[model samples]
Target: MSFFVSDRAPANRVSGYKRRIVLYCLGALLLLLVAVAMGAAIGETAIPLDVIGKTVANRIFGAGYTLDPIEEGIVWSYRISRAIVAASCGAALAVSGAVLQSLLRNPLADPYLLGLSAGASTGAVLVTVIGIGGGMVSLSVGAFWGAALAFGLVALLAKAAGGGVSAQGTGQIILAGIAGSQLFNALTSFIITRSANAEQARGIMFWLLGNLSGVRWDDVWLAVPVAVGGVAVCIWHMRALDAFAFGADSAASLGIPVRRVQVVLIAITALMTAVMVSLVGSIGFVGLVIPHAARFLVGVRHGRLLPVTALTGAVFLVIADIVSRTAIPGQVVPIGVITALVGAPGFALILIRGRRMR
Candidate 1:
């Protein structure tokens, strides 16, 4: 005598799914704004959020809002620049991770895992120590070349190992990447030890561990555009990335030029990584961990996944940078250390979850 209840239709289900995606994106954006504010406001000297807003408004609009020079310097010059750089680097690394994971169809794939960071680091070190390209050369230029070299080597090695940007070839590529990273890292260590003095070594060590202490507007200008552009490019290629999730054969059958897409995406990733590493020196884990965390929230669709991952990474790293500066009263911990401490545990959880799913 009971009446059957009406079932939800497919259109309704799709609408509901989209609603959830929108909500997730909005939430992430809100969190990112809060994190940015916190990062700008909380530091060695704790500028208020109101002061931050006034300083920003005054700068943009030439409003007559006035603050002490020290407050202005702390809020406008230092904290804001550092936060922006952290956000840019985080977004770049996360986007690179998402691209790499999709390209390789391997959960653990990241820009650093592919040797880009080590290569860039080597290039920067060479420039710093040996004065490569004469004294006029910038570290960013060296990093760009270094990253390109590493990428080329990894591709060559992968090709020799019979890995041609396909899922079946992922293991070979990973091994090649590991080898390339070790080789570059060894070269970097040797150069530092052989050439750099103790003071120079200390500076290099801090940079290698990832420092944001000296980030200025110039760094913000350098990093933000590249990161934003890179993210845009990845989003434009979301369809190809989606095809890649199914493997090369399937992607090719779906009319995606698998090799071409792989090459382009890998180049973009390397470019972004090099830019960030050049500015901040090789911060890790954002690329390795953020994509997986985003996937948990947004599913595997790159449209939703990429934006969420980028936003989450921006928020995560800004907060991490805040902790790095404030954690020790008289000393600033390297941003990399905080990320590793946070990311390692998160990574372990991901491993446990993956095992359970399998």
Candidate 2:
């Protein structure tokens, strides 16, 4: 596998690199475990860490001290599901962002930048306004189709601009993505405006802003498959992502199979985006910010970057959820809102740093 490992020291330096990778992976794993525990422990009712651990153990193996039905329900039904949702969505968005930045060869590439979120929102909005499923599955399906359409349109437009399905410059793709996003976003707004119910309008608006409240195990089932599949696809095409970083022609010359891989990645990303957005509306800075943060931690190897990005994303989302719920008394902010506030400034800093480096 001629893929970039992000940390590629010479053979003589292999031992040191190996140690670093192991430690990094271990640290990320520890962070994930802590985040999960902490996320489960900090809801409105406030389960202690020991209780949280006991609840998890009981749920997993029936070996720990048992709680009453109410406590069990809170732990099993509310906190665990919520924590899982946070971890899954965060990991999915972060990895998606990382893959997108590499694939687009632009630091700013994200689900929104590629119109996947908007497209998925369009589909989801269609079902919501028109009435799709009575439940989460129906919503997820609608969002999936919306994302597919958005990404499909962007891909087609990019192809047309370059005279074929080839990787154009970052500028072309980003511009095309922006155009696609605007078109879909407009369509979504139109749908909301035409809706007869005020509640529906509010729902649509909240969905766009993103939230992880009311998460159920059903949402977990819907999100996990898509996230896992997308991660697998990214791993398989790690080399292609690296090739893309050097530019399309360079990737092609290196036998990276640019167009085919590009299509595959876009499809994977679109599906994952739809799943995520449907479950938790349009969480913005996650895809934009977490990848860069994780990259700084893990260097830039896709093998390492892919996993670490996912882990950091999970941690970031969990912490964000904690703050969203606990930052104010008797009030909970939307997770997406918190992430954007946190992400946007740091993202700007990254851009400034990039410019300075140049």
Candidate 3:
């Protein structure tokens, strides 16, 4: 009997791949659970871990636990919801960043690359400052529509500028996004400067800087589904992301429809970014910082990179949220502020590492 060495090698490789995937999934799940638990248990008012666990069981599984109504209410109503939204938002933005980076081949590419943040800010300002919706639309709805409008404008600009999906076209899209961002940002500033009262200006500014104070169960419901779907879509197209990272010509040669994949993935990322921005305001640093961190750890293969990036981001933002609440006693800093504080330094480190690698 001859030993089939060739077959053994292929089978072994397949086994290793499956093992890596399983290990990654389990590790990510464990860390995420721990981070969520930490966020729920530690805050301005600390809730006991047992109480939180019991409250979650009672609320989610109908576990009969004789717990304080106040503790249960806090756990079920505010903290848990906030933690869930933070995780969802962080995961969405980070995955969007990773996808954009791979697709655009720009280390700096982020969910806001297509002017979503600027547009959302302008839209929120329009609703709050200009009263465009006349109290009919909430800030979240206005911001979301604004983001959608911005995405459309950017796409039109990129196409009209004569860059389809070539390497040159990648730069074209980035330029178009920059121009659109400037226009919307200017509009937001103008409205705030000319129309908004001090209180209104303050409120919009805080929201634009990112605030999770108002996150509730409704937000969790909205954010969780969007995050899950967007991430699933990205994972499903993992091959396309890797292909795009090489070049459009290469992706096309590989039978990947370059333009279609580009458009669909960008739209999905925009939706993820827009929804998260709507829920939590325009949180910065997450989309820009998390992907690079993930890439540094996992290398360039998107199959491994995407999920690690998302989990890292989820944990990072949950921790950031905790810091924002606890950094200054009795005063909740903007979540954006905490992220910026960490991200700016992290960005510098990434640059240093990149230069060294070069």
TM-score leader: 3
Measured over all alpha carbons after superposition, the RMSD of each candidate to the real structure, in angstroms, is 3.8, 5.1, 1.8
Global CA lDDT computed for model 1: 0.87
lDDT of 2 by residue, 172-218 (tens): 66778899999999998888888737988877777778777768999
Q: List lDDT for all candidates, in order.
A: 0.87, 0.80, 0.91
TM values, all candidates: 0.90, 0.88, 0.95
Candidate 1, poorest ten consecutive residues by summed lDDT: 1-10
Q: lDDT: which candidate is best?
A: 3
User: Can you rank all candidates by lDDT, best first?
Assistant: 3, 1, 2
Q: Write the per-residue lDDT of candidate 3 for residues 67-148, one digit (tens) a residue.
A: 9998888888988899999999999999999998888888888888899999999989999888887899999999999999
> How many collisions between residues are there in candidate 1?
0
Q: Tell me the lDDT of model 3 at 90.
A: 95
Arrange candidates, best TM-score first.
3, 1, 2
Candidate 1: stretches off by over 4 Å: 1-28, 163-169
Question: Model 2: runs farther than 4 Å from truth?
Answer: 1-23, 132-137, 163-165, 169-172
**Higher-TM-score candidate of 2 and 3:** 3
Residues forming the 10-long window of minimal summed lDDT in candidate 2 = 1-10
